[model samples]
Target: MTGIRSGSLVAAVLSLGLLAGCGGGSGNQPESFENFTAEEIYKRGEYELENTRKPKDAVKYFTEVERLYPYSEWAKRALIMQAYSHHRARDYEEARGAAQRFIDTYPGDEDAAYAKYLLALSYYDQIDEIGRDQGLTFQALQSLREVIEQYPDTEYARSAILKFDLAFDHLAAKEMEIGRYYLKRGHYTAAINRFRVVVEEFQTTTHTPEALMRLVEAYLALGLNDQAQTAGAILGHNFRSSPFYQDAYAQLRGHGLQPEARGDSWLTRVYRQVIQGKWL
Candidate 1:
C-alpha cells in the first residue's frame, strides 16, 4: 500500500509540470501594446501625460513613439511631450535642449511658441540667490526678455514680465551685495557707483533705501559734507521711518551740523544755496 501511494504522488507531480510547460508555450498570446496608427499614438501620448502618475515611464513610451514615426504627426506630439517630461523630472539641461530643437525645427508650428517659453523657463528656474553667483540669473533675464520682445501678445509674454520684474530685483540685490563688500573694505568710491546703479535702474526695489544710506556714507567719507547732508535729507524725506534716517541724523550731528527740524535738512539748504551762488 505505501509503494502504491508514493508512485501515485510522482505521477501527479509530472502531470502538473506538463501542464505548466504547455501554458508557457502558448503562441497566440496577445501583444502587450497594440500596434497603433500615427494619430492613435499621438492620442495615447497625450493620454499618458494627462492620466498617468509615472511621468518618467510615460516619457520612455513617448520617445519610442517619436523614434518609430519621425515623419508622422505622432512624432511631433511625442517630441513636445518628451520635453515636458524632462522638465517635470527636473532634468533642466535635457528639457532645454529638447525645447531648443523644437523651436529650430518647427519655427512656424503652433507649438513653437510654447517650446521657446519652456526653454526660457528652464534657464529661469536655475537662478541663484542674490548673494551667490548671478550668471544663471543674467541668462534667465536675457531669455525672458527675448520672450517678451518676440511674443508680446502671448500669455508667455505676460508671465515673462512678472519673472523679469523678479529677476530685476535680484540683479539689483546682487549689485547692492557687491556694494556692501566694497563698503566693508573701505572702497567707498567703488561702492558708491554700485549703489548709484541701484538707485537709477532699480528705483522701485527694496534695495533703494540701503543704496541711499550707503550713498550718504560714501559722501561723508569723501569729505563732501554738503552732498552727504543732501543724501541724508532725501533718505529722511522718502523713508521717514527707516533706521537709516536716524543713523544719518546722528552722523550729521556728530559733525556739528544740525539737521533741519522742518522741511529739508540744513545740508540740502546749503547745497541749493551753493549751486545758486548764494553762498559766494
Candidate 2:
C-alpha cells in the first residue's frame, strides 16, 4: 500500500494534457465536471489525487471521466485511477470493484496487469493480522496466483510472488496460533490435528518446524510414544538446526524415547516422505 507520488502523477497528467493539445481549465471553469472534456476531467482527478491529497475526491473525478467519455482512452486511464484512488482511500470494496471493471472492460490494456495487481492488493492488504478471518487470506492467495500466472513477465508478477508467500505463511501462522491454544488447554488431539495440517499442507512455511515440535509434544501427552518419536525424527531430519528441533529432541529424551519412526501412523508417513526428499 505505497502512496502514489504526487509529483509523478501530476507530471504524467500534464504530459497527457499537453499531448492532447488541451488545457485543464482556467480559473473561470465551471465547478461542475459535466462541462469539462475528458482530459480536463482526468486532470482534475490527478489534481485531487496529488495536490488535494483527497483520494475519495479523486475517485469522484475519475468516475465522472468514465461516465462522461466511455470507451475513450481517457476513460480507460481514469478507470485505473479510480481503482487506485479507492485503494488509497482505504475503500477496499470500491477498489476491487473498480479494478475488476477495468479487467473486464479492457483485458488487453497495458494497465490490465496493474488492475489485476490492485485487485489482489484489495484482498492482501486486508490480511493485516493473523487473528482476522482467514477467508481474506484465501482470497488474497487466489488473486495473487492469478497475477503470477497471468502476468508472469511483469514486475507485478514478481511482487505477487512475494506477497503470495507471505499470505501462505500467514495461513500457517493462524494454524499455529490455534494449535497452541488447544495444546495449552490440554486438548492434545485437537492440537495435533492443527499441527498436522501445518506439517502436511504447509510444510514450506516457516511454521513447519514448530508444528513438528508441537506434534511431538501433543503425541507424547496422549501416550502415543510411537507418533511422538516419529514427529521428533521428522523434525530432526529436516530442521535439525531449529530450536524447535532441539526442544523436540529434549522432550523425547525425557520420556526415555529416541527420535525415530516407530509406527505406521501419519508422522511415520511424513518421516518416510522426508527420507525420500518428498516432504520439507
* lDDT, each prediction: 0.73, 0.90
Candidate 1 per-residue lDDT over residues 1-280, each given as its tens digit: 9999999878655543443232234462323223444454454445556766555655655766676678577778778777887887777888888888888877888888788888888888887666778887888889899889988999999999999888889999999999999999999889988987886677778777688778778877887776676767667666769887778778878787643322354446644554565532
In the predicted model 1, the residue pairs found to clash are none
TM-score to native of every candidate shown: 0.70, 0.89
Candidate 2 lDDT over residue span 1-280, tens digit each: 2346877677677655552333334543334555567887788779778987999978877887888789999999999999999999999999999999999999999999999999999999999889988999999999999999999999999999999999999999999999999999999999999999998899999999999999999999999999999999988888899999999999999999999999799888888888998875
Candidate 2's displacement at residue 64, Å, is 1.2
CA RMSD of each candidate after superposition: 13.0, 6.7
Task: Give the number of the best model, judged by TM-score.
Answer: 2
Question: Against the hidden true structure, what lDDT does model 2 obtain?
Answer: 0.90
Off by over 4 Å in 1: 1-53, 233-250, 253-280
**Positional deviation of residue 33's Cα in model 2 after best superposition, in angstroms:** 1.8
